[model samples]
Target: MSNNVVPAIINLDVKGPVISRHLYGHFAEHLGRCIYGGFYVGEDSDLPNEGGIRLDVVEALRALDIPNLRWPGGCFADEYHWMDGIGPKDERPAMVNTHWGNVEENNHFGTHEFMALCELLGADPYVSGNVGSGTVREMSDWVEYLTREGDSPMVRLRKANGREEPWRVPFWGLGNEAWGCGGNMTAQQYAAEARRFGTYCRDHGDNKLYRVAAGANSFDLAWTETLMKQLGELGCAYRPTGYMQALSVHYYTVSGPWRDKGDATVFGTDDYYRTMLQAARVDELLTGHSNVMDCYDPGKNVGLVLDEWGTWWNVEPGTNPGFLYQQNTLRDALVASLHFDVFHRHADRLVMANIAQTVNVLQAMILTDPDSGALVLTPTYHVFEMNKGHQDAASLRVDLPSGVPTREVESKELATVSVSASRKDGRVLVSLSNLDAGQAADVELDLRGGAVTGVSARILTAGELQTHNTPDAPDAVAPRAHDQVTATASGLRVHLPAHSFVTVEAALA
Candidate 1:
């Protein structure tokens, strides 16, 4: 720690972009039961499924107030042939999933199923197009199929497929991780291809498409620079119509080591530190990529989309590792809350983001039984539910007077305090997760221009750090309404619990 220097103060700046509720978005990929047994079935399942989409799952997601949903693939979207999904179900060609588990894709949950599911949840749809192994016509037609209302071949096919009205898909991705799973294409190649495909991506009357070019792998600033150079405002550039909306980036937290991902359900001081250390990278990737984008377009012409991000780890043992289904713990709750704070703080340059998988996949929210009608809420879900107040609210920068130490997870020197602010329905909501495990922090909030009248917190913590929900002990770790909060004379003093994450809502009088 520094003797003279104090903790950095975060300013709300009075005003900023209204945090889009969509920023608290989620993702669903074809990997694992994330699709087949997770969100969809054969429409004949006994486990409360509708049109193959699970009913309980939809209702649960709705409870989280999910704003937008990215679909089809993490790696799956790159090779996704959107056509095979439409038309008929039985006759649909069977495709093999090479990147993920090599399970033969039945193409049951195609475009129609996905759009309809999105409609059921009332969430905006974010579709990742195929740039790795797909063509421009295929990608363009997909936009038309979902958006165009008139007599285009794609639209006609869509109408015949079951949906009469266009979904008005608002978000579109040019590609998914082209540097890796997508196609192993160079940044320059993907950028040029992005322009070519993005140029022709027309929006049908009702549907407004925000085309995002495939972004760099992780910390590839060179790729971002090259892509920007090609875009150089190119004289009248794209179109009177919006050609490109955002440049995308994908990053996952693979802590300590990847080969030995350790236990997904285990947590200790070390686990907490490693998790926060890795999770904090969201902030790094944003600024690093943002700097590169600014060099090319100083005007901030393009939005940076963290389309895919979350804690990555070894899949549950006995489960197909390739499916990426893992357990979630209170540590995951803190990670989720902290990541949301990152996005809120960087809401300007970052217009949109989606957690990798919503259910039954990487750091998923809901874990369901493939056979039984049972479902368990993961710590990630509670984080989303608790921090939902930040949705669509203007971000107010928050600063703490002191710093904390992360002694457990190898970041013992200095640990960053996780905090983000948003105003909703006249109340200022501050979601804070102290990275320090088992050590509570006294947060003296200077609610400038506001008075702290009351505080309510919903916290997720457990008796044991590694305690998790198994089939038999599903409720072992869950969030409970907490009460160690009170208003103070100077501002407000709230005792944040140790190894716990809380969403504290302050009433500004």
Candidate 2:
């Protein structure tokens, strides 16, 4: 065991906000290989698959207990027309994915395909409707096609396309990034459009819809305020109707400008520090946005959904620039953990979040090579796997004093330790991260509100900050049993390695 330092005492209280499992949600889009090569490899491919979906990817995602998956598009959602993707695959209309890759979208993987994927993963489907290019009637018909059980033209169309029974999609995004690619409309304009589209997005028999309006982009507080104020003006009666249930926001951790987001793997200590600083800013963004939400929604009736978030680095060498594909690293994992910690602490207002693209896109969880049939789980995937225990667990309040500290790019003091605690199934799980690059931390955990009987821990770390897994070295950075945790007379003590993430599960007495 490493030498013990000044321990950071963490006192956790059992009663707190209940962490929503949807906070561990994911997002998938029609960009690059995210759909075709990453998740679905074709039924005829030589690679092992379950009904055209990659078995390896499916198993990996299922292990994380992915609660929900936002689909169709990020920017692609606004431009997409659902009718083109249904019916016979060969006869379906082909269109150019102008928002992502300028390549042809063959329409092979459409609404049915996404729902089928969701079924296999046991995840709820959150479909983003096309409001920029498609009409309100088109959006209404799409929802009806998926959820309506009674006789309807859309339902009949779905049946003709092969599905006998309708699928249940509880979450519906009114539009995506309406302030930009979604239509470049003003906040007031988008609010009116959202209301119009949401009004017609009727709930099918027994199928309730959680309508989410497209929120601000990053620190655009005015956009959030304008939308919420407009929705709030609609009065209480409209709340139960098709009004906004949540507002969606998008934020990405980019080290540099949009054109040059820096390299994913080749970076120095400064880049690492800066990237983490940006990741930590999510807390600030959420706090500021939630403050605005409280003004119009003092009751906190509507939730804030972080629908698109993750690190956006430079595209891989030789890949199409528009694809937004970047390799995942330990830095990405740290970013994910930081975000999870923030989401857990603010579970009251932040109900759901989706980490950008799940596979083969920006900060992807899994990377696949179609040529070699190589499937490797990224560091971000392990972070998700380790924290899966916190799903649906009641958030535990942890009071952690500043420990060993590191200075970020702006020379601001940052605690080397970050943590969040939750309880479920009579077990208390505490997730801790040691952010220092070269110093291990001995943390004294003060457990309150319960007696601890047993403790077991698992940690994911690497010898080098830039260490990552390739197909050839898939096990380079994976989780291993951490045996340094012990129940102290006062509470519990844990030894956290440098540049590592550890999850401690304690049996409560």
Compute each candidate's TM-score over C-alphas. 0.93, 0.96
Stretches of candidate 1 exceeding 4 Å from the true structure: 1-13, 233-241, 401-412
Error of 1 at 31 (Å): 0.6
User: How much lDDT does candidate 2 score?
Assistant: 0.87
RMSD of candidate 2 to true structure, Å: 2.0
Among the numbered candidates, top lDDT falls to: 2
Model 1 Cα lDDT, one tens digit per residue, 388-469? 8888888887665565444534633435456678886778787777666656665655556666566777777786566667
User: What's the TM for model 1?
Assistant: 0.93
Q: What are the runs in model 2 whose C-alpha is more than 4 Å off?
A: 1-13, 233-241, 401-408
Q: How many clashes does the backbone of model 2 have?
A: 0
Error of 2 at 481 (Å): 0.7
Candidate 1 positional error at 332, Å: 1.4
lDDT score, candidate 1? 0.78
Worst 10 residues of 1 by lDDT: 1-10
| lDDT agreement with native, every candidate | 0.78, 0.87
> Which residue pairs collide, candidate 1?
12-397, 73-77, 270-408
